[model samples]
Target: MKHVTYADKALFLDDDSADWLMEYARALGSATMTDTVTLRGIGMDGNEVEATFLLNHSTELITQTTQSGLQGPKNDEAVGYMQEQTRLILTPPPARSVDDPLEIS
Candidate 1:
């Protein structure tokens, strides 16, 4: 499990979830954008719960491994989505040509 500290709140998430969240935050910062994301994680009581975070250029997120005996929540789909979003931000698609053959007159 990993601990993600944002502002004054800390959330315990799985390794992938925490790592991808950090990377996505960096990408969002580079793009000068803002977004809200929620991921399943271990709450203060060691039970599974959803934690939300706001990512933006001025926001900061920290992650670190934890030795808690509780198993972290598995959020593969959310992790994948965040990874893809980060990729898109870091490597955006090429712009379409205005004079392309497919353009309608």
Candidate 2:
């Protein structure tokens, strides 16, 4: 058996940037490594509300193991390790530096 894991991250944004970020997150939702978004509302408590996102990711693995290794599919162990090593943070999710060539604006 193979186990699946999920993870989430949150980012804060101002009024204008929040909208843009939300839209961007939605667009990337269908990708293999995109942020699953849950837009939070602003509060009057002087604390900035955060835009919570579940990075639709896989990491944890479930499998039967013996002395040698996993006793499942041939590539299960490799895939599981790869999944764990894969970064939950998505490409083009946010934070483009000034020197980033991919930045359009």
Candidate 2's error at 85, in angstroms? 20
- For model 2, name the residue pairs that clash: 3-62
Error (Å) of candidate 1 at residue 87 is 0.7
Per-residue alpha-carbon lDDT of candidate 2 for residues 1-105, written as tens digits (9 for 90 to 100): 122112332222333333333334433444545443333333333343433444333322122212322222233333233333332323434666888787367
Scored by CA lDDT, what does every candidate get? 0.87, 0.34
Candidate 1 versus the native: TM-score?
Answer: 0.87
TM-score of structure candidate 2: 0.26
At residue 58, candidate 2 shows an lDDT of 34
